[model samples]
Target: MRRREGENREATNLNVNSLETLVTHIQVLSGNIADLTYLSNVLKQSGDWLQSEQTRLAPLLGELNPSMHSLGYLYILEAHISAPISKEQANELLLSVARFINACTAEQIHLAPEKFISVCRRFKDQVLLLDEPLRGVAPMLTALRKLQTSCEQLTALHPEFLLLCLLSKSYKTGLSILEDDIFDFDQPHDLFLYCYYGGMICIGHKRFRKALELLHNVVTAPRLIINIAAEAYKKYILVSLIHLGQFSTSFPPYTSGAARKYLKNFSQPYLALVESYDTGKISELETCVQTNKDKFESDKNLGLVKQVVSSMYKRNIQRLTRTYLTLSLQDIANRAKLNTAKEAEMHVLQMIQEGQIYATINQKDGMVRFLEDPEQYKTSEMINCIDSSIQRMMMLSKKLTTMDEMMSYDPSYIREAEKARSIFDFDDVDSLPLKPDIDAHLKDVSSSYDIDD
Candidate 1:
C-alpha cells in the first residue's frame, strides 16, 4: 500500500508539471500566431484562433495546484495583458513571480529539459499543430532551448537576464512567421532570438537601422514575457535611434513613466550640459521627467536615482584611487599635510586656477614646488605627519612579529614578549593619527575603527 501511494504521488507531481508546461507552451505559441497575423496577410485569419488558445491555456493554468511554480506561471500571464498596463500591477506580477520561483527552490523542486520538452510537445499538438504555428518547427525548438537555458535558476533576485532572453525569442519568432514563405515560418521563439541577437550585433556593427527594426518588434510584443524587458530594451533602442539622429522617433513610450526617466538619465545630463543651447532636447528631457512626476516622486523611483548617484560616486572614488596609487609616498605625504592628499590636491588645483600657486619646476635639480597657501601648507603638513605615523606603525608591527618568533622559541624571551605586549601607550609612535576635525568626516572613516571590549 505504501509503495502504491509513493507511485501515486510521483504520478500526481508529473501531471502537475506537465500541465504547467503545456499551458506555458500554448501561451507562447498563441502569442506567436497573434503576432504573425499582424505581420502578414495570410495568417490574419488565424488571429481569433490564437486568442482562443491563450484563453484555453489560461484555464488550464488555473486548474494546476497552487504551488510557487504555478504562481510564477500566472505572473507571466499577468504580464501579457493589453497595452498601458499599470506599473503597480506589472511590478506586483514581477514580484510575485520572483517570490514564487524562490519558494520553488526552497521546496527543493527542480525542473529538467526532458519534462519541459514533453510538455512543449503536448502543447504543440493542441495549439501549434492545430493551426500551424507561424514560426516553423526548427526555429521554435531552437528558441525554446535558448529560453530554457536562459530561464534556468529563476530564483535569482534579478530574473531580468532570463526574461530578456525569453522575450527576445518571442518577438523574433513572431517576426519570422511573418516572413514571405508560409512554410518557412521561422519558429516564433527562435526568430525572436535572432532579432534580439541580431539587433545587439547590429549595434556593434553600427547598423543602427537594422538594430532598431529588430528591437522595435521586441518592444511591441503583445505577450511580453517581462515588463522589465520592455523597459530595458526600449532604453537601448532609443539610444541607438538617437545615435542614428532619429530624435523624434527615438524619443520614448510616453505611458511607461519608469522607462522614460531611465532613458533621460542617459540623455538628460548631456542634453543639459552640451546641448544647453539646444532648447528642444532640454525641453524633451524636462518634459519627460515632469510628465512622470508622480513616478519620480515615488520612493521606488527615488531609490533608483539614488542607486545611479551612488554608482557614479563610487566610480569617481575608484578613479581617484587609481590616480593616487601612482603618486609616490612622499608626494602623498606632502599632499596629505595640506588637507589630506585628496583635499590638498584639489586645493592645489584651486590655487593654480586662482593664480595663487604656480608650479616652480627647477630645470637644474628637477624638483617641483607650489607657491602654496598657508592653509595649503598646513594641510600638506598634516598629511606628512599621518604618513610618518603609518610608517612607524609598520616598523613596530615588524618588530613585534620578530619578538613573537623569539618568544615562541625561547623560554627567557617570553618575559620580554609579555612586557612588550603589556606596554600600552596612547602616545605610541605607531598609533594612528586622529584628525583635529575628523568629526567632519566621521561617517566616512568611523566604520574603519576597531573597538574591543
Candidate 2:
C-alpha cells in the first residue's frame, strides 16, 4: 500500500511540474494569439514559484525565444529581475532584454503585460547603472512604442524615457512625445513625472505657455505627497511671472490640501517676488531678486529670475503702450526704468518683432509710436490656426462623449452615481471614478495605432 501511494504521488508530481508539459502548454497556448491574456493570468498566478525556480531559469529561457514565445520570455525576464547577477552578467542581461523588447511579438506581450513594464524598468535601471543614459534613450523609446496602443497613452515608460531625454539633452525628441495630449495614464505617479519632466522640456524650448500648463498639472494634481508639487510650484511661479507678466495672489481652488499647505513653505522666495511684481516697480522686484539671489541660484532658477526682472521692463513698456500714443526714447526709458534710450529702443524692437506689442521706433528722433494690434485675422496662417482649433475642439468633444457612454455601462459607476443622486446638493462632478479600464481597448479606431506594429 505504501509503494502504491508513492507511485501515485510521483505520477501526480510529473503531471504538474514537468518542464515538457509546461513547454508544450506554452507552445499550444501561444499558438492562439487571443488566448495570450489567459496565459498571462496563469503566469501571474505562478509568479512566486517562477521566481523561486532560479535553477530552471536557463533551460526555460533557452526554450522560450521572444519571437516564438514572447509571453514566456517576458515572464522569465521579469522573474530574472529579482534574481542576483554579477556586473558582467547584468550587462549581457541588458542586451538580451533590449533584444527581447525590440523583437518580441507586441500583441502577445501586451496581453501578458503583467511584467512587461517592470521588465522595461529593469532595463532602464541597468542602463542608468552603466551610466549611459544616452544608450537607454532609443531602447526606451522603442519599448514605449511597442507597449502602447497609442502614442498618446501614458505608461511607466513615459517618465523613464523623459528622464533619459533630459539627461541626454534630447529636448527636441522629448518635445515630440509631449505634443500628444495624454488623457490615458496607468498611474498618478506616471502623470506627475510626465508633466514635471515635460514642463522642463517645454522650458528648454522657451514654450512658456505650454510649460506653465504642464507644470500646473503637477502642482494641482491631487496627491498625498508634496515634493514634486513643491518643485513644480517654484517653476510655476517663475513661469507665471515670465509668461503672464504677473502672478495671481488668488490661489487655485482645486489644489489638494497637502499642496496648499506645504508648497508655500518651500517657495517663499518666489512668492515674495510675486509680491514685488504686484507693486509694479522694477526697483522692488530687483531688490527682492538681489536679496534672494543665492536661493534662486541654489534652486537653479537664476536665469528665469533674471528674465522676470527683464520682463518687468517689458511689461512696464507694454503698459505705456495702453496709456501713451507716443513718447521719446529717453522718456520711455525713464518711465520703464531702463538705463538709456538705446536700451528702451532695443526692448521695443524685440517686443514688436515678437508680436507682443505693435509699435514703431524711429532711431533718428528716438521716438516710439504705439499702435493697435496689426493682426487682420485674414491671413492664410490665421485661418489655418482657427480651423485647427475648431477641429481639436470637435475631436475632444467626441472623445468625452465616447468616454461617457463607456462609463454608463460600468455597474460600479452606475452604483456610485446612484449613491450620489441619493445625496442632497451634490453638484460636484469630481465624485465619479476616473477611467475604468486598466488595459483599455486595443486598436479599435482605424485611426488608432497598434501595439503589434
Query: Candidate 2 overall Cα lDDT vs. reference?
Result: 0.76
Candidate 1 similarity to native, TM-score? 0.21
What candidate 2 gets wrong by more than 4 Å, as runs, is 1-29, 34-42, 53-65, 84-90, 323-333, 340-349, 358-372, 401-453
Model 2: lDDT of residue 259: 68
Please write out the lDDT profile of model 1 over residues 1-453, one tens digit for every residue: 978955753453344334355444333323243322222221223234333444344455444342433323433333233223344444433333333333322111222223223333333222222333232243333324333423321111111122232223333433332222111222344344344444543443434566677666544433232332333353343434234322342444432333333434534432332232133233443454445545433312332222222222223332334444244323533533332455444544543564444544343543335342446535777999989889977976886788677659997667765775688311112111122222222221112211111
lDDT by residue for model 2 (1-453), tens: 978955753453345465566566566567775556556666666678778876676667777768878997787778866676766777887888888888898788787664888888778777766767678888888888888888668977887888777666677888878989776877876787688888877776778899999998887776633555676788889889988987875558977666666778999999999999989998899999999999887666778788888889999999998999999999999999999988988888988987899988887888888899878999999999999999999998999898889989999989877896787333222221232321121111111211110
Task: Quantify all predictions' global Cα lDDT against the true fold.
Answer: 0.36, 0.76
